[model samples]
Target: MARITHGIACSHIPVLGYAFDHGKEGEAYFKPAFDGFGWTRQFMAEEKPDVVILVYNDHASAFDMKIIPTFAIGCGELYGPADEGFGPRPVPPVEGHADLAWHIAQSLILDEFDMTIINEMEVDHGLTVPLSMMYGHVDKWPTKVIPLAVNVVTYPPPSGNRCWALGEAIARAVESFPEDLKVQVWGTGGMSHQLQGPRAGLINKEWDNRFLDRLVGDTQELRHIPHIEYLRETGSEGIEMVMWLIMRGALGKSTKALHRHYHVPVSNTALGHMVLEPVDGTVPPSPTLEGNSAAAQARIA
Candidate 1:
């Protein structure tokens, strides 16, 4: 059966992509940020997962005001780069795992998590930047991807616990698949920094590090943090950190940190990255899809 081998969480600021695309890695301002992913590249090379479940938010690129899905999964054959105002980044098109994506969508719905299923959509920097950060300048992404877009742009995005629970559901779906595949789920965005308003440039290193600590072992406590606290303390944009919970939730209860890197001033955001693997070397038991759906139906009655 297919299984999620590990989880990854990182910041997906566009400036980091610009730096790598424009050959600014050697520059003083961006070197530290570039250096942060060195270990991740090495980790990917070693683990070599067959597919990646990329979790990120669309920045008004794919879904405009017309429609906003709190949770969307890509079930297309291919996805192209979106031109987010500036031109589209010069990156190869992303290949999607349509079969796995379809299975996940069906399973998640049966698990009582309604999700928007898309067969077509252009991906913005929020998705591509994280790929670039991990794989570097590849002609094509090294592995197939299942894009999971969370609605962080919309006010009152899914709560921390909701995202966490969704991750657990995804883990169950992945394990139930019959294919012999190795998969990794990634959550990208936020390390504290505000990109708008009078307090446009806010970076709280102490808060960011403490959050990382909680992610490693204290997620039970971290999952309870409210959205207002993240917004008020980390900045409006910093609320993006909630998306990280999805990746954390999918990894099961016990995880061993393989590698972690944190750096500041990557444009206006703090960059954080970490690799985590299940310590027990086995998938955890998750709520059965049929059971969950039945429970949901029972609640309505």
Candidate 2:
């Protein structure tokens, strides 16, 4: 059966993609920012995962106000790079693991977490920027990807605790799969920044680092944080941190924090990255309970 052995979290700022595409790696302004991902790239090379379950929010490219699913899973054979106004960043299309994706979709639904299944979709920077951050300029991504798009852009998005429980459902799904494969779940976005309104160009390094500390040292307490706290403390878009909880919950209850990188003023956002290898003997959720059940919540709590 497939097992999720590792978990990764990073901020997927569009400017990072721009930097990689424009060859700004060695430039004085961008060197420090780009250097933050050096260790992640080396780690990816040595780990060589077979599939990546990328959890990201679609930034008005794939889903607009017309319709948005609270949670969408891509189960297609391949996903092309979205043209986010500058012609798709000149990168190879993201390959998909349809068989595993379908299995996960079915499992999530059966676990009572509603999911919209997409046979075809184009991935925007929210999904690809993280890939570039870790893989650099490659002909194709190193491994297959299963895109999990959460509706953070839409108002009344899923709560932090709910996203965490959904992660447990995902773990149960991956564990039931018959294939012997290495899988990693990556949660992308937010370390505090507000893009518009009176609070534009915001970067709260103190809050960002505190959040990271709790995420690495005390994740159980971290999951209890509410959306209003993210909005008020981290800024309007800081709510993106909720998605990181999903990646955390997937790692069961314990982890070894391998690396942490934090930088500031990368465009309008603060960049954050961390890696986790699930500790052995961490308990997963009970398969008998519904994904959103109170008992399931306690497992994550």
Candidate 3:
């Protein structure tokens, strides 16, 4: 069976790149993030995963308020950067893993996930930001990517539980593929920092620290919390912390943490990264439990 070589999670703030380009904040913070994921770049060089399931939210670029699908899978041959008021990035168009993507889409729909399959769509900073951070300029992205863009903009987006379920669906999709190749799944955005309205720049050091601590060992607890609560406590836009659910869902409950890092002051965001690989061949505990409190059942369901 082809295994997930490694999993990574981070925020895709396009402005972070603009800052690095314009020399607003010193390079001290961003540099380490790129270097620490050096293994990712190297893994791409060696393992050259045939597919990278990228989970990111679109920034009103490709799919505006017009029609926001809770989960949209891109099967396009190429994807360009969105203008998004900042103008498109000067980077080569992203290549897609059509074969693997189609498999996931079909499987997800059969599983009743109601995903939107896109063929000719442009990805915004929501994706390009993390891509740039993880992999610098190269003649071409080493591996093909299966873009899964979730709608975090519109009202009543998918619940944190739903996103977590999608991660499980993703694992199943990869496992079902008949190909012999390595695969990687990435969930981008949120450690904790709110940007939007006058409440922008709201950073809760205490909440952020607690969230990180639980993220590694007690993610099940974090999933039980409601989205609105995250907003009230963390901030409105900070609810994107729900995005982290996708990452937690990908790892086995008994997995070991390889590395972790946290830093604030990325413009107005808390930059965070964590890498989790399978441990001693132990399978992750099932997210669902047979008998649990109504709340626990609700969180996993």
Candidate 4:
């Protein structure tokens, strides 16, 4: 069976594309923060996983406000770069693991996560920015991928607890797959920053640190935090931390942290990244009964 070897979580700030395109790689806005994440390239190199199941949310770039899928899986052969207001990034297309994505979609639906199956979908900076950070320009990505896209843009998105539970479901799917391959599951976005509307450029370093701490040792408390509280306490539009629980769930109860990095810039968002490897004999924590129950009812309601 394919083993999900590790999980990587990160933030996908659009400014990185701007920095790359403008040839200002040395500018104060991007230099130090970019340098701090040097560990990412190293971890991917050492692990050299066979497949990477990337967990990220789409910006309105690919799927518009008109139709949103709470969870979507890409089974396409390749994904193109997105055109933000400025223009598309000059990057090669992203390739996918079709066989693995197909199996995952079947398994997740059987387990009742009810995801949208997409055979052809283009990934925006949300997936590519992190890919660039993690793998750079190889002839091909070091590892193939199964793209999981969550919906965080529209109102009444999936709950934090729901995202967490999906992580557990993903672990089950990965373990049950009948291949003997090493895999990495990556969750991207948010530490405590906001974009869109008047609340743009807000950062809460204190909350970001607390989030990292709780995410490691006390995720239950973090799962119980409601979406409104995240918006009110963090920022109106900065609830992307909901995606992090997916990585946490995949890692199960305890993990050895290989590395962690955090930075906030004037470019309108806070950036963070984490690398977690599961410890052997780590059992999956019992699903948060109350939170999952409430999420189920919300779906039904």
Candidate 5:
């Protein structure tokens, strides 16, 4: 039967797409952040998931200040990339998994989560940047995607606990599907960075690293982190990290970090990525950052 096989979490910086489109991925300015994705791409190629349930927030491109859905799922034949000023990034449109998407939507609503069902919505960089980072510049994404857009952009977004519970409901929904499909849930956005105010260029590496540690193992404490703490310690936008909890919750009862990378100052943002597989052992080891302090080493091989 269809089942959640793994979880992937990463920051989705719009500049990553710009660098990729301009062939600046290898340039000195962006190489450190881009290099961190190499192991992820290789890992995805080896154990390519049939579908990816992408959890990300929508930028102004899809929904403006007028209205925002706390949880929205895209159930369309295809989801084209949004045109964020410089035209849509040159990546292939995201093909949707309708059957699974519908099933998930039905399951979530019945489970008491008010999920907005969307038939038409162009995904912004929040969705595309992570795909580009993990898959590289592919003509077409290798797997089908089910977009789960959480409303972290607007004030009073879903709580960390709520997102986590939604993910558990999703796990149940996926398990009920009869098709023998391999699935992966990806939580995109945020390590730690504030885009405005006096702390515009903030990058709390220590707090971000601590977050990565809690994310992989100490989920009980991690999921309980208040929004105010994310704002106070990480940054205003750091609240986006709540989306990762949904991905973590969907990963069954427990998990271990198989591969992880953490880098800083990627366009003034901390870029973090991790691959979590369900683990039967005790809580996974604290992310033993290797190599240098600026770059956390990846161990997928």
Candidate 6:
């Protein structure tokens, strides 16, 4: 079966993409920010994953007010970078694993997690910026990607617990796949910052660091944090933190932290990054849970 070799979490700020594209890395203000990804890039080079299950939210670029899908999985053969206002970032298009994507979508729906299977979609900064942060400006992405877009922009987005559970469901789906692929699930967006109204430039470094601590040591407790608290304390957009739980959940209960980096004021967002691998260097075998495929098929029928 395909194994989950690593789990990564990071903030996906579009300005970071712009900075890298415009050769602003040496600038004093952006140096620390760029430095944060030094270790992550090295790690990725060493332990190359065959595929990346990228988790991010569309910033009203792809899915606007017309239709909002709580969970959308890209099953297309390829996805183009979206022109979010000022034309597309000069990044190569993302290649997708259609067979694996279709398998994951089928399993997720059967597991009762209603998902919108997307055959074609334009991926915006939320999806591509993380890729740039991870692999740098490459001729082509190092690996294929399965873009999993969550509806964080819409009010009353999926709760933290729900996102965590979905990650678990995705883990099950990935483990069931009969392949020798090395997969890594990435949860992108947020440490803490609100970019609207009078509360525009909010940043809670204390809360952000505390979150990173809990995420590394006590993830279950961190998963229980309410959305309202995140909104009230961390700032409205800070709720994006919940998405990280999905990556954590997919890594199983215990993981070894290979590298971690945290920096503040990256275009009004607290930039955070971490690389986690399964403790035993391989995912546990799929569990024979109560939900049998026959019963799942019956439910689907």
Highest lDDT against the true fold, candidate: 2
Reference-based lDDT, residue 197, model 5? 99
Give the distance in Å from residue 242's predicted Cα in candidate 1 to where it truly belongs.
Answer: 1.2
lDDT of 6 by residue, 1-301 (tens): 8888889999998899999889998899999998988888988998899999999999887798999999999999999999888998999999999988988888777777889999989999999989999999899999999999998888979999888878877887788788889999999989789999999989998888888777664347877898898998789889888889889888887777888899989898889888887664333333433547685543223
lDDT of 2 by residue, 1-301 (tens): 7899899999999988888998998998788888988998999999999999999999988899997999999999899999888787799999999999998888787667889999988999999999999999999899999999999886798999889888888898888788999999999999899999999988889989987887664358777888888888888999998899889888887777898999888897899999988875254655566455664443332
> lDDT rank, highest first?
2, 1, 6, 5, 4, 3
- Alpha-carbon deviation at 162 in model 2, angstroms: 0.5
Q: What is the C-alpha lDDT of each candidate?
A: 0.86, 0.87, 0.71, 0.77, 0.85, 0.86
On residues 153-255, what C-alpha lDDT tens digit does candidate 3 reach at each position? Answer: 6778778878877776667666667778688777887766677787888877788777767666534676677877778777776667677777666654545
The sequence of per-residue lDDT tens digits that candidate 1 reaches over residues 276-299 is: 887653434445534566644432
Residue 269 in model 4: lDDT: 75
Which residue pairs of candidate 1 clash? none
Q: Say what the RMSD of model 6 is.
A: 2.6
TM-score of 1: 0.94
Q: How would you encode candidate 5's per-residue C-alpha lDDT over 26-130 as one tens digit per residue? A: 999899898888988999999989999999999988888887889999999899999999888899999999998998887666666788999999998999999
Cα shift from native, residue 259, model 4 (Å): 0.6
Ten contiguous residues minimizing lDDT sum, candidate 1? 281-290
Task: Give the 10-residue window scoring lowest on summed lDDT in candidate 4.
Answer: 281-290
Would you give me the overall lDDT of model 1?
A: 0.86
Q: Which stretches of candidate 5 lie over 4 Å from their true place?
A: 280-301
Local accuracy of candidate 4 as per-residue lDDT tens digits, 131-171: 87787556577777788998887878889888888888778
Residue 190 of model 4: what lDDT? 80
4 or 5, greater by TM-score: 5
Candidate 1 root-mean-square deviation in Å: 3.3
